[model samples]
Target: MPTIVRASVALLALGLVVAPDALALSKRDQAAVEALNQQMQAAEARYRDAMVKIANADPAGNADVDGALEDMEDVMAACAKQKGCSPTTMLTAYKRLLKQNADAAAGEETPDDGADDGASLAADVPEAARAAALLSADGQRFVKMVQYNPAVQAGIRRWLTDMRGPLIDTYENYQYMRQLMWPQFERAGLPEALLFGVMAKESNGKVHATSRAGAAGPLQFMYATGRRFGIGPDATGFDTRYDPRSSAQAAAEYFNERLGQLNQSIELSLAAYNGGEGRAQRVYNSTGGRNFWDESVYNQFPAETRDYVPMVIAAAWLFLHPKEYGLTFPKVDAKPALLRLSRPSSIYELTICMGNGGTRDGYMRALRNLNPRYQAESWLPAGTTLSATTRMVGLYNRWCLQGQRAELASTLVRSNASSAIVRTGPVTPLPAEDAEIEGGGVGAAGAVTTSPSVSKAKSKPAKPTSYTVQRGETLTAIARKFQCDTGDLAKANKLKAPRFAIRPGQKLKLTGCEG
Candidate 1:
């Protein structure tokens, strides 16, 4: 079988202990090799960054990509030419130096840098990323035993007390979306507990969660990382990074890709996922392909990562055996179904009508999870069929059709500023004589009149000549939003009729129509 080399998260842990061949290098040769190694690292970083930039672009364009590629070519050529400087050797050296730099720079206790690691705190790591399965093995037992460790015990205590609400929220949210997200892991032969652990830690199963560094979705994928794994804006302008199924697939593929290259340690795969893949691989390789839990390997990554691995393990264990920790996961009725709207309504309206009747907490999150493509307040046209839960269908039948609750929902949703922000004063009555219309016009009586200029101006405002597709926008929705003909908008953008696909950052012209 062919090895899968991923765009990101490759080339870190060679997983082989470097033993010198019969030909050993002198001190001078070693120094020269180190110098060349640094050069190779610089070139690789530059190339990787450029590729990431291009991947995140609308049409995969990057001006610096060519230059970076050329530099990599030169570096690789240099490596192949030099007797002591192979690509693997160079990368190993880079990893060693990187760890040295990180260790030197990181204080005994550095503040959590959530930007790179995608998580925070060793204190919370135990419970953040956790999962469990029916596996019975020494490794599984070790993972379970980790929950009783002092560090993990702190996390469990926090979960049972201070962090209880957030933990419950994540669990509930995960259950609703598990059907859509878990299959990817199962198909990939990855653990479901791991998925829950990462989901809980990353975005707490919130599909719309966005980080300051532009990571989004249930798994919180950064744009560049997501693009590498087929997660990006769709033709309808919905970012696939925020889609549960797609993001889960991407995350699974990414983990597998790292697994193929690294020491095959889940901790290392996660390290690459949190800290860069190349960095994780390098650390693994530098240490002769040893365990990630080793003091040398553990301290090499950021403090955040050190905590992340253990925490994820703990979370996974708890997910598997919540009862052991005196925690009970709430039962959810999440059987899938399609809900065809009998009347035009938004998720907000539907949620209001559904009430808190069936479930303890309402169906807002359940509704959102089942239909991730649509926003909560987006109005769906009547008869629009959406992915939903059977419970939702039951709730809809009972409350949202045309009863007092339905009427109240519609009224509440439709109550606009115009009606609510009423005129405080009494209504102004028109003059007995007809009011004169402005714009240099005379009427038969005191009636309002319009000039040719005013008449021309009174026509509906001219539509914008162009539009840039924003995230979550669709051709049909955009046409409706601007009151333009859908066909014209599609044609203007040279889009096909039935399925007019558009991507975010794409521009479209207003052709042969007015809004």
Candidate 2:
């Protein structure tokens, strides 16, 4: 029999949204509402899955599942206090129960079976089974964690009830990556749950994920690290870290190596992954060679690393038991397979080719999310086969095809617009009738009399004032410097009227200004 954990009830209470019935909802009206609800539920499920996967795959350390549960309960209580909020929302109710459970679990120690399944599972299960098993364990642990942590339980409840849409979407995207990457992770002997943790820390599932430190893949590998693991950096400036399969494989190898060196402890290995190995080792040594939670170990690391472990653990725990935390994870329309691209194309180009569909952006986001080794300023060259989620293959293919056309069109346009300017000399003043024929229309010369000052100024050719365009300067910049309009500058220079493109060190005529 499937064990129905009562903790989920608390989340339900906290997460349910109840709009006031000023207007009765019709069947049709409720249809859209129902659809939205389904979508939110789906998203919640996805997030939960991703979090579980991360925990399952985590080779470094187990997250603070207990703390996350506490937070979830606290969030539930706060939501219960809200006037319009419903306690039935999954998030709200789950948190409430989680807090209650946490309180109940405190100081209650189960007899030690000496099994250490979590440790055994981490070591024995291949990447795939481990992911599945860990997720299951993570869910159970989450129940225990929330039952222990009142503060996190409340936060979880509030997250589910308020802003259900965004939270759901985040979780959905996270799950999409999980389903797509599980197989590769299984083959690599790495925990599948680690992917979610990486995604959460690196991009929060944003595909076009870029870091300030120049990490660009979903796994967030640096150039040197990626290359060391067979995801090469090529002459065409191709960084294989952007390729999901390649990056995943590389990350697996890296993690495996780290584990081998770190006494096969996922916690220490993960600590090394986030905060350098040296620091993790130092923390381990300082803690008298105990696990990650030791006060000495926690204090030895940076604040970010200290916070990072708990966050990863929390996400992993939530993924396993989203319902317990009043969190929903969404299911994405993605396939589980390697996608081969015959031609090389950019994410931007591929997005256009995919008929502007949902999958294109999703894939691009995943690639950007997982492959932190690729730089955005450069484009991935052609003939690169990328491992993509099955759902995104068609869109990626379309993007490749469209990219070729876009590239060709751009090239043609550039060729046609060479630097040579065809000028019809300077404007020559003509008789009124001829001027009317050539220059659209004009008043009779005598009728449009110039002022004495203007006539005198025209009679004497204006002094030639030359200005040079500097680096990082545009026509607008130059115009601003001289306190003149860009249109005026262009006209005086006899280049064009009201439009101009300037290059560095290019000379321009400044009119009606003393410089």
Quote the lDDT for 402 in model 2: 55
State the C-alpha lDDT per candidate.
Answer: 0.66, 0.50
**Model 1 root-mean-square deviation:** 19.5
Give the C-alpha miss distance for residue 50 in model 1, angstroms.
Answer: 45
> Candidate 1 lDDT (Cα, whole model)?
0.66
Best by TM-score: 1
lDDT of 1 by residue, 1-515 (tens): 11111111122211111222336888876786777777767865765565345334422323454454345445555554555666656545434533433443354343243221111122222221121121111124335423345656655666678767777888999888888988777555466777887887788778888989888998888889999999999877778998899999999899877866763467788888888888998898899887776778878999888777767766777787798888988888878888999977778889999998657879888778767787776666677897788888988999999899999997776544433352233334345554544463554344434433432323445668888889988776676556555556676677853346779989888675444
Return the top candidate by lDDT: 1
Off by over 4 Å in 1: 1-148, 417-419, 424-515
**Candidate 2: residue 37 lDDT (0-100):** 41
